[model samples]
Target: MSAITVIINPYANRGDSQHQIDAGLQALATSGLAFDIQLTEYRGHGAELAEAAARNGAEIIVAAGGDGTVHEVANGILRAAEGSEGVASATLGILPVGSGNDFAWGLGLDKGVDLAIDRLRRGQTRIIDVGYVEAEGFPAHYVVNILGGGFDSQVNIEAHKIMRLRGFAIYIVAVLKTLVIYYRNPHATIRFNDETHEFDMLMTFVANGPRLGGGFIAAPHARHDDGLFDICLVHKTTRRDMLLMIPKFMRGAHLNHPKVTMARAARVEIESPEGFPSQADGEIVGNDVRRMVVSLVPQRLRVIV
Candidate 1:
């Protein structure tokens, strides 16, 4: 037994969250990890719990939910660790008990909850890279996986509404729904890698982890430890072309596509006259963000995967 705190979002999986939390505790008990679980009482509660735990010198904080839960907990831990000694030393652990679990998928932790617990018990740690988004009107924030905009964010917006379904099915339906409703590409200028390029794009992703939307390999070449980010820019395409390329994106074979631009950068700035949808780790950022700069925070997080 070590000093660990489990932050569980009761709303995760869109089902019986209490049952899920209980099951997780049961699993943890068998693993012999002395842990206490805190059920999130409301929105943004995960962050508060995480910050409190980290400030109290907890060694490990487990996000026992989905990507959104992980997002909030990471934000809390990073914020608490800011400008403090030994506070940021808390390593993160994940149990993929949420819809999609995209962050876990990218880290090769999508295997099973038992396996992740086993890894955690072993205390094996990997220090991975992180990202931060700086926008004009929004507070600066850290991102562990992907920070994306344009059509993909729209997909996230639609995907969150399908309460009847969970996981990849919901995303598939959302993708179809967005294709019909959100066909217009936002006009923008992306400045990065010492070059400024302007285009009307369906989406642009500043990727730290490779996969998103459960299985979409948006950045096939991305590595968590790599200081560089794999930036994927999809230029505007016709509706028919978009449909035709869906499978290619699923297989991560779209990198070589003509309309797709694959590049690596440590810093990127984007400006748009009319804002596009923005999302980080499957959560919507701002409704109308005109400008944003995404920069890499190298090896900022220690995780057990």
Candidate 2:
């Protein structure tokens, strides 16, 4: 059988991820599998480690951190595949030790560390789709879950500013702050799957998998292997409407609101009259740009459970 290499992010989950790693390793060892573990030292190190493991013939490369670590590792594996010859793709696995673990939640892998590790040891792999964002100023990259523009990106920016908070609190505080300080309706023209529409949108999210920022089910019906994306556009609304929608979002019922528009497409392009801020997988991208393209890569990854 092929060996597994786990790339760990020690700083995940407010620096409590090491304990999870210890538990995960114990479970893997109990499963009688030969595996190796590598800890990332800084930003982008996990991606580099994942690339090295893939090139070294690892059959499985597990991301042992949060969403950022997962994103970096996926990028590394894809980069390695693009640069290599005659190498089969390495399967990707996640042990959710991050604050949000939103991608894990989408996979129904939010049970706990032991369960996630057990699934990994069982070696069940499923091919899932990934999303990519390309724009004028930013580098093209992949997003395994949701990508956001406008108000949502501002939340991500604010959340990072107060990283000391954990999970939903970070997002909740950021949302309140954004609502009070930075809420703006940006005029945008969106084209998806050949249909074009214009609106003054509060935010636009292209979702491959549901949920972001811990528990907000931005796209409740998203399926990662469906070969399509759920595009949600929130029209300009009153602050009272935004406040009322928060509870609905917590219950994954925000789509019922009249101001929220949801559609499924294989590709989407957003053009803003004065540009907008955007974020993918909790990473900020772009400032003021004319256009942004979002697309999906179906069954592009084999993930553990």
Off by over 4 Å in 2: 83-88
Q: Write the per-residue lDDT of candidate 2 for residues 5-121, one digit (tens) a residue.
A: 988898897786778878988888888888888999987798899988988888899998888888888877777777444323998999999988999999989888999988987
Query: Model 1: which ten-residue window has the lowest total lDDT?
Result: 15-24
lDDT of each: 0.86, 0.85
Candidate 1 residue 169 Cα shift, in angstroms, is 0.2
TM-score of 1: 0.95
Residue 177 lDDT in candidate 1? 95
Candidate with the greatest TM-score versus the true structure:
1
> Cα lDDT for residue 53, model 1?
91
The TM-scores of all predictions, comma-separated, are: 0.95, 0.94
lDDT of 1 by residue, 1-305 (tens): 34989988878888545565676678789888788778888877988998889888888999988898898888888888788543258888897778878888888787767777777789888888888889889888888899999999999999888899977888899999999999668888998889988999789999998888877889998988899999999999999999988889899999989999999999999889899889999888876789999988787888887
Point out where model 1 deviates above 4 Å. 16-20, 84-87
Residue 155's lDDT in candidate 2: 83
